[model samples]
Target chain A: MSFLLWLESTGFGTFVRESESLFAYPTFIVLHTFGLSIVVGISVVVGTRLMGLAPTIPLAPLNKLFPIMWFGFAINLFSGSGLAAAAASTTIPNPLFIAKIIFVLTAVAVMVVLQVKVFRDPEVDDKPLDTMSKALGGSLLALWLLAMISGRLITYIA
Target chain B: MNYSHIHIVLNHFPTIGTFFGLALFLYALWKKKQDMQIASFVTFMVMAVLVIPTFITGAAAEGAVSQRPGVNPALVALHQDAAIVAFTLLVLTGTFAWLALWQYRRFNAPSQWTVWTVMGLAIITMAMMMQTATLGGEISHPEIRAEGVAEVTAPPEGEEGIAYALQMWMVNNAWVWPTGETLHFTGMTLLFGVMFLVNFRLLGMLRGVPFSAIHRFLPLGILGFGVTMTSGVLMFNADFHRYVAVPTFFLKMFLVVVAGISVLYVTIFDDTWALGKGDGTALRHKIFAVTNTLLWLGAMYFGRMIPYLE
Candidate 1:
């Protein structure tokens, strides 16, 4: 509770909450929203391809999106921190917030697993995705979608 | 001249251009000439390209006419609303034309899906455009609203009463806004992800890969745009008054038009999709590519700032 209060009172937090400038809170929200889409949305597209949606799309070309996924993640990291800081007292103890964080972490883990086990392998590009690979893609997609929903619900439930 | 004059001059091109393209496309299909089909597809895209300027001038025409005597504001409003919907559909047809062109360039023929979808969308777009044009004519000419026909009364205000019922429902629902926010982001991801790849190809990063290969994902990008556009309309209708005087919204719309034209430029210009490339070789191509990138990025930024800025 004390830490929450301290965080809420910080300059960054106060600006995020109180600043009327377009560059502040609103920009953070926009960045966060676009970032969420790229990170999770790219994964969904890649996953869909793996699960046999638009098989004609080259699997190798999709690896180019990994850097973009990371870029989105970085944006989200900063914007998310700003968001949490702005309402630290409310957000810190909120069960939805906690669940959102957990989902985000798990989603990231699933993405990493898919990235390492499936996307990185050059041999898998020409061949059809094996059942296990398809399942991993499907799992990662579900995790990210759940994470997005949870994150969206945090403000309402909090 | 003024916007009204400009609007009058440009307005007929889209309608006429579409007919010309449709005629050729139909002829091509009847004759079973693949080359003519490709040519006709190009014509449809050219027609789409023409729509940008015409649609932009439409708002100006409305603004000009609103100030004049004997014009019914409600009728103008109806025309403006219909124009927005028609413009959206027409642009979608443009996107389909781009895919068709890309397919033709790469595979020696356009995809069957692209062919059928463009035909269907073109028909729909033509119907809507004709409706919008008629409404617009009613605003200025006043003859089309002759008392004998369907009532020429101004459309009633306040969500147009039940025409906007679904919009009202979404607005009233708490979950809708948040869901919209989440989906809006998802849409951005799909759009930007594919766009970034396309621009990089122009920048010469993805060598040896035909532009058509990346172009396959254009539909995905369009789908994303549709999601965001739908969400945006829902939110705007929820509280339209807040936006009437907002310069940012207008700026966003203007940039969207410019950004849209830039996309069409990238699509129709042969230099953009040429297979033998290591970065766009020509200075003009490079310029167009860079401009296209900046325009899209600018449009996105403006869209994001709509609620925040003006």
Candidate 2:
């Protein structure tokens, strides 16, 4: 509790919370939104393909998307940190916020599993996607939806 | 002149353009002229982009006209309802027309089923636009109203039927606004992702995939746009006063129109559609792609900044 309060009291945190400058709080929020759009948006697109929406799109080349998704994740990490630091005491203890974190983490894990078991397969383009990969894809989409819902709700419910 | 003047000037384009495009499309189909078909598709797409500004400015026009002593509020409401239906159908027709052109570029001919689908949607949309236009005329032009028609008594306060109830539900419920926001955010992500994939391909990434294959996913972007527009309308219906006065809101809307037109450009224009695996885009295509991407980003920025700017 003390650590969280201390984190919130830091100069950076104070600036994020109190500064009238658009660059301070709003920029972080905008970056967070852009990051969310990139990561979850790309994931959903790739995930839907794996779940059998557009089979003509070869799976192997989609491996190129992971780096972009990671770049988005990196943006989210920094922006999210700034946001959390600004209200550490309230956010850290909020169950909705905690759930959002877990949802995002689990979604990322599912993305990695798809990357390895699906995209990395040597015969991925030649063979039909296995049932396991399809299930993973479905789960990935569901997890991201939950993450988005929980993240949005935190603003209101918390 | 304000938005009302702008609305009147721009409003005739969608109805007239759709009728013109539909006639040309049918004539092309009869004559088997692919070039004419493409021209009609372009017409439909341009009308779609123009309709965004037309529909938005209608709200401003409503505010202006509804304040006049002789204007009937009930007539305005009825016209708005019809306009909503027409607006949605016109946009759908435009999308189908765009897909038809994209098909033509990819396969050397648009699919028979898609061609028929566009025709069906365009026909229905044309009818809706005519109905909306007539209702709008009746709002101020009593000369256009049917002779001896009964005066429309404004419904007692708080009794304007389903639209009023829905708006109240959105306002009265605690969860409604946040839920709309969540959906809006999700929709934005979906929209952004698809736009990124398509525009980046023009910007030279995703080279292994043919433009046609990525083109198949444009409907997903459209689906996202539909979700966002629906949720956005719900929010606006609930609290339009917050939006109407905000300069950032107007800027965001203007960017949406530009981004929308840019999407159509990449859809039908041969420069990007002809791109195959390992193909490099022209410099102009690259410039358009970058502009489209920035327009979307600007829209998102202005939309997010509305509260602060206000």
Reference interface contacts recovered per candidate: 0.32, 0.60
Cα lDDT tens digits, model 1, B94-158, are 77887887667656677899999998988888898888888778776756675733345554555
lDDT of 2 by residue, B164-271 (tens): 666799988999998999899888877888888888888887788888788778878877887887798778766766787787888898999878777876666666
How high is the lDDT of residue B257 in model 1? 62
Any idea what lDDT model 1 has? 0.72
TM-score of each: 0.80, 0.90
Instruction: Name the 10 consecutive residues with the lowest summed lDDT in model 1 chain B.
Output: B273-282
DockQ of the candidate models in sequence = 0.36, 0.71
- Give the Å error, residue A65, model 1: 4.0
- Candidate 1 lDDT by residue in tens digits, A1-158: 99999999999999998998877799888778667756776676777667876665566656667887888888999999998999999987888788778878877887777777777788766786789878877887777767777777886776
TM-score of chain B of each: 0.75, 0.88
Off by over 4 Å in 2: A116-128, B102-117, B141-150, B156-163
- What lDDT does candidate 1 reach at residue A17? 89
Off by over 4 Å in 1: A53-64, A126-128, A153-158, B1-10, B27-36, B39-69, B77-92, B95-99, B111-117, B143-145, B148-151, B154-163, B206-212, B237-241, B264-290
> What TM-score should be assigned to candidate 2?
0.90
